[model samples]
Target: MDLALKKQILQKAQDWFVESIAQNHIKNTEKLIKPTEFKINPFTAVYLANFLTGNSNPESIAKALVYPRVLGTSITTSFGTNIQKFTSEVLSAFGSTTSGIDIEFIDQLDGFKKYCQMKSGPETINKDDVETIAKHFSGVLNLAKTNSLRIAHSDMIVGVLYGDSGDLNAHYKRITSEYHFPVYDLSPELVPFS
Candidate 1:
C-alpha cells in the first residue's frame, strides 16, 4: 500500500475502534444490559487493544473477549466458498482449463484458499498472500474491504435504531438521505443452492 492509503486505513481503523467502544457503552446502558448480557460476547477492551496495538493475536483477543466464534467461522467459510467460485470463473475467463494452469499460480491460489479458511487458526494470513490475491483479482479485495466496512458501520446504526425503538422506515430514510446509500429493505438475492 502507498503511504497515503496506509494512513487512511489506519485512521479508519482507529475511528472504528473508538466508535465501537462508544456504541458498546451506550448499548450497555440503554438496553439495561449487564456486561454478560452482550449478545456478541466480545469485550471492547480486548478488541480495541488488538486493533490499536497490533501486537496481540487477533484470535486470542477474540477468545479473551468471548467474541462469538461462529461469526468468524461463518465469515471464513463464506470467503472460502466465494474464492473457489472466483478462481474457477477467472480460469474460465482466461480460456484455460484449471488443469492447464501454471503450477506456480495454482500453488498460490491453493495457498490463498487455505489462508482464507484458517481464519481461526494460529497461523496468520501472510501479507504477501493478501497482496497477491488483491493484485490477481483486479481490486476485488479492495472492494471487499470497503463494502465490509460500510456494512459493519451500517449494522451499528441499525442496532442503535432498533434499541431506541426508533421508526425503522425513518431510520432507513435518514441513512439514505445522509449517505446517499440505499441500506434499508435490501436483502441479497443469492443463487439457489450455490
Candidate 2:
C-alpha cells in the first residue's frame, strides 16, 4: 500500500470508530436497546437470572434487561462493514471490480492484477462459508477462461483485514491449505508467517 492510501484508510477507520462510540453514548442508548434482526427483546432468561440473584430492585431489573445490548455487537458489525469498504475503495485505485469479484488490485511488487474478496478477520467465516468462497472463486475463474481473460487461480485471494498469519483462525488456514486459495493479511510486512 502507498502512503497516501494508507493514510486515507486509517482516517476512515478512525472516523468509523468515532461513529460507533456515538451509537452507544448515553443519549443514544436507545439505539443499543433496539431489537436486533434475529433477537427479540424482553429476554426472560435475563429476568429469571436477576430474580434468582435477588436483585429485584427496579434499577437492577432495568440494568439486567439492557446489559446485553451494550456488549459491543454494533461496534463489531460496523467495523467489519467499514473495513471492507475502505479496502475496496483503496484497491479500486489499482484495478476495477469488472471481473465480478469484490475488488481487483495490481500488486505493486509483482505488477500483476489480483482478484480479492475482502474479509474482516480470520474468525469471521465458518465451515459452509469456506466452500461458498471456493465456489465464488471457481466461478470467476471459469468466467475468465470463457472470455480469454488472462487470469490465474493463484490470483484469487482472501484478504483478511485483521489477524496475522500466525494467529489466523482455522477457516482461513483451510482456505489456503485445503481449498487451494491464498489468504493475505492486510498488515505491515514485519509480521511472521510460514
Report, for every candidate in turn, its global Cα lDDT versus the true structure.
0.32, 0.66
lDDT of candidate 1 vs native? 0.32
- Per-residue CA lDDT of candidate 1, range 114-169, in tens? 11111111122343533332243333334547677322222111111011113233
TM-score on alpha carbons, each prediction: 0.21, 0.72
- Model 2 gets an lDDT of 0.66
Question: TM-score of model 1 relative to the true fold?
Answer: 0.21
lDDT of 2 at 86: 61
Supply the TM-score for candidate 2.
0.72
Looking at model 2, residue 130 earns an lDDT score of 85
Winning candidate number (TM-score): 2
- Which parts of model 2 have CA positions greater than 4 angstroms off? 1-12, 19-54, 89-100, 188-193
lDDT by residue (75-132, candidate 2, tens digit) is 5665565665566443343334544356677766667787877777767888887898
Provide the clash count, candidate 2: 0
